[model samples]
Target: MESLQEKNRGYGSIFRNLNFFSIWIGQTISVVGDFLYIIALMWWVLEKTGSTAAMATVAICSSLPAIILGPFAGTYVDRVDKRRLLILMDLGRGVLIAVPGVLYFLNQLQVWHIFVIAAFLSSMSTFFNPALASFLPVIVNKEQLVRANSISQMSSNLSGIIGPALGGALVALFGAGTVMILDALSFFVSVIAIFLVRVKVEQVFPSEERKRFLQELMDGLNFIRKESGILGLVVLFSVLNFFVAPVGVLIPLMVKKILKMGAEGFGVLGSSISVGMVLGSLFLGMIGGVRRKGTFIMIGIVVAGSFLALFGVSESFWTSIFLLGGCGFGFSFANILVPVVFQSKIPHEKQGRVFGTLGTISGGLRPISLALVGVMGGLLHIQMIVFLSGVLVALGGLTGFLIPGIKKL
Candidate 1:
């Protein structure tokens, strides 16, 4: 692993590393499967229950694990073999997600079953995600991280473009149960793809007399505090998430209420953002390494926020599409760079915990932001709330320039 980093290979060499390529392929397949699974599951729930509340309940169940198990999950990831853990997560999710399809076939499927499976799956991801973050540095050289992330980002965006349309069509033709079964099969394929990867990970901590879980968790938190700009970055992202959360909730309203464009218009607006992200990632990949990463992060945020503010004021549907696309393009810069910063700045041994802590903070913020959006939705016009949120987000990005902690990073 150390030898790979020392090589300092060119950007295109990222794909030549079979280890990284294997995992990337696995992750790409898994991401698309996830979209298929979610669309099928949510659609089935809505179709059967005829209640939006049930759909929301399922969503809440899926998110609870990350908020609850985040720190602990990270600690565990640091203590174990990440490769084995990734396989286990894929295996577990593949099986658990299949339960719904099996039950449906047996005429025993229930809303509660979906809830339980979703929670358990989320718990697995809480560990899997951090482990993957920690594992990446081990497989690829440092020089490849940016391009690797860009390619990964591109795959996700591509999946976003393809998955929902394919999932919806499959669900319409074959039923949700069949779509879910196929998703399960996709995970198994991921397991195989992951199994082919090979790498030797060094032991970071001594085996004997390890600290208690809570102590290690605090150590992770303290690391964040002591590190330059990291804590600020975390705070920035948490607040940014709060401001951005409303965009998803309000887009449909803007299309339906303001533009009177309905579901077809909403789909078009959504796809535009995904297309923009794909292009943004491609551009980043072409540029290779960015010298002033902090400046890039702030620029990305401001661009995204500016477009979002424009989106709020867009009375025309086509205008809203353009604005949302710009929002996605701007978002990609910050999204890809933030992880690169973390992966580069943090120690490999502590990366798991740091990533875990990030998951907790971000996941914990989701519900609060949603609730605030709901409250603001009732009091003020949607346009006002979105415009204000965008302005605040843009200003929040500007703070990175003012605060020495973030600016110097």
Candidate 2:
């Protein structure tokens, strides 16, 4: 009992730092804004086009730029000050979102306009993500990585739970444009929070013989290929994302068409998933860390895939909500473990590029999946398409078991 007590205390001490708390706060605020924007964006697109394909296209636009520019963004992240990179990314997104709002007020809003903005915002996000992944270690000790990630995940889930519901109400009362304004304001708040945190940014490669941008980009790709564990994880995530894409694209359709619900139903459904994610993150946080993370991740993926399949099969609104919520929980469980494993294993110098390359490839697969689902859902029944996606997701996890290294994560 005494030894167990000491172990728990030791683990708790790892996350007991001022810097980690500050960065965590900034990330939380940013996540809240992201969640709100997700609901607002989906609603706006759905209202305008009245098509699932259009909404999925919006999602594709938001993610494709990030995928295309991921390698370059990763290289750049390694070269620049991460804090400044984060601040600039937030500001860029804030300004871009404001453009759509201003257009709405001027009665110049168009579906294409939203798609373009989504692309630009996603492009900015491409840079932000790798930097944040690399920056977390600089601010927190390695021992606390899991805990920090768990806290971050929990906050993100909490935001997801609350943001969509609030965004729905705001959009219902005020307008989608007004919700955009709130999202923009949230970015400013995030920027200010990040600005207050002070940390020494470590240089990955000192100034000695600068290489061409293209050369540097290739270097990042090569790095991933050479690193077996990193490459394996990237491949796994890409597969997972491809299958999971349909879930995001179809949720709106499920609420609007299948469930015979409105935007408010969408909000409630989204919130239910968030609630489950929060629970999952909290469970991970309490555990602090685990041995054999790879096994845990595989189990999570299998569970998530099963839930997705179940969600598609069920017609009862309550049953769908529970299934989607379970999917969210399993998804977060796998997600939190993946990053922790990568951060723990990958060297600081190589993190940005590896994460970037991984982000690009994995992110790119999602949009293609979305487009496929959106188009297919139009022709086939939504439930059938969703069920197929769930099968793919399950297959992806089963494939992971075949890969010895990933099975061990």
Candidate 3:
């Protein structure tokens, strides 16, 4: 008995209320641009310096700033309007990216320029992530959190699949500077998409009129310390991150040294992982949401770690590709579970601080892991190093069993 207009209105309301789509679209654009910039920057550094350490430095600098600024950024995100915060973060990054692009065109490009820009962009992203993570639950219904996170993961994976291939061609044809220009433009597009979304912010601790900065920070830390389930998840993820960090540095080495492939091969290797991630994400999205998310996450991590270890040992290109792809799929599956749990359990008001603290711990450890991986890979064989990383991840998974909630999830 319902009219078509009424039916359509129902659909319209459903779509509009789901702010995940908006965030997903914006992130997709930004991620693709980021991929392009990453390829371009790495190539630019290699061309200029011809040093693997120099190239590795790019990764370290990019991550360190976020680790340093994460706590303060998280605290600020909780206090501010998340929508505007995202917009401003995008704009800030866009302008920073433009600095190098403009200078490169004017023939003033240098390795230091890339380092500075990478650090600046990384710092901006520290603010952006905690805000975005905390904001998602506010805009989307709790029932849709898993689906929303899955869709977001799909967008990121798709970007990973497409962006590197596009970046390779662009780097070959137009140069890194041009690719950077494209990245800067993508940020503008993201800013526009974020601007269109409307969100209702909930204040968690209404009784605390105002608190000192250090007091507020300590409060966030205390919240995490008090929440056993959340604390356990954070510890579990941090250990996982420590082991997984090697993959980024070691993948390039494997393609270049072990596989004896060039830049195109590197692109192919990266794209292969992305392909698997996309498929995994699609599977998760179609399923709506997993009921036993923690269990699923643990299983995924175990599978991913196994694949990564196999990937390190494989000699044939196809074997390596398949293993890496499998790893990507498992990684995506595990990734979707974490954010859903965080959004579901953590109070909306405290999300910023909690996620920030988690970010600080996880993000801080990554670069140290990368540095260790780089140094170890340099000192030992790449395969052995990678295999060790995989072993660590698998061992870390056992920690989940110790945390009862994680095993139950």
Candidate 4:
């Protein structure tokens, strides 16, 4: 057991756990590469095809795999050696991502090629994410979960700050092919770093106890159904995602049409959110464990929703930046701690399936929400849409308190 002193040792303490640190370093590097891939791929497709529909295909291909494969992928994750699965996923994605770059240099890359690769890579992610989540609790002490997750969130946020600007410069100087290759190399870095970490997993399910695969998947859903808090949390996130996902699409329209700001203003607004997330993550990590987890999560939801609402109404560019930043800060609490709660509440063996189901539900909402936002934007004012979404999000968060199961969590 971890002593009180060790448990209370703060964020720096997680770095001393070599396994967590190794995976952290690898993932941070990989996330930067991911951002590079996004920028390079999107820019290349749009530039080459000059078609918005072509660009939209990239989104559809990337997202469809998760909705299709999520449950089965989670079932596989629970049955496999996570470290080995993770390595394969990283290696496969690395190789797949390099294909476009290779083909580009050979003058053989096509729009269809990008579409296939994006789908394969997204399929790999369907496996990698739940495996990573399931693997974390096995490798570290329970006391370290929050700080560990916080540090993980912080690195991704930090990468968001650096990756695009860096990718844009590289794409300009060297071209998308070179950027894709760099992104592939980043995945290799992750593979090597993860390889160095040692994890000893105790098999909780005996061969005799193992059921058919479909039954196992059904069991996971059953667990969620029985656990009212988990069910409530999942629904809350699904609803919140439906309301918030369109903000990404809306922000550009807001800046261009409503705020009368340039591309620079759009960039600044995006960065403001990332910067706030970094600070929020850093703050949570440093604080270690938090009590009254339920209350904090609710407050986080309200704070984020309130700021987003304020941003919707604000005419001043600077004020919008500030509100978006606060919105990001408020989001961090729920983002980091909810997983911590899940890690504690769910049985280790079942985590992969449960997280996968939750992820699919949330991820599935994104495309639907974005599509609706397009239709709604045609009929309503963008500011009104933003304001209404924010209000609904806050109202959704407030419902958590009303649920006896979630309120007491």
Clashing residue pairs, backbone N/CA/C < 3 A, model 2: 293-409, 294-409
**TM-score of every candidate:** 0.86, 0.94, 0.92, 0.87
Name the candidate that leads on TM-score.
2
Candidate 4: residue pairs that collide? none
Alpha carbon lDDT at 262, candidate 1: 37
How accurate locally, in lDDT, is each candidate? 0.80, 0.82, 0.79, 0.81
RMSD of each: 3.6, 2.5, 3.1, 3.2
Residue pairs of candidate 1 with colliding backbone atoms: none
Candidates sorted on TM-score, descending: 2, 3, 4, 1
lDDT of 1 at 363: 64
- Encode model 3's per-residue lDDT on 1-409: one tens digit a residue: 9864454332233355546567777889999999888777776776687555666678888888877788888888888888998999999999998888888899998898888888988988999999999988877767667766777787788899888878877887887889899999999999998987876675566465867667767767888787777777788888888888777766766776789876666667777888888888877777765887777777778878888888878777878888989988888877788899888887887788778888887666888787776566567888987888887787777667678867665
Residue-level error in angstroms, candidate 4, position 42:
4.5
Model 4 lDDT-worst window of ten: 50-59
Q: Model 1 — TM-score against the truth?
A: 0.86
Model 4 segments more than 4 A misplaced: 1-4, 41-57, 102-114, 168-176, 252-268, 312-320, 374-384
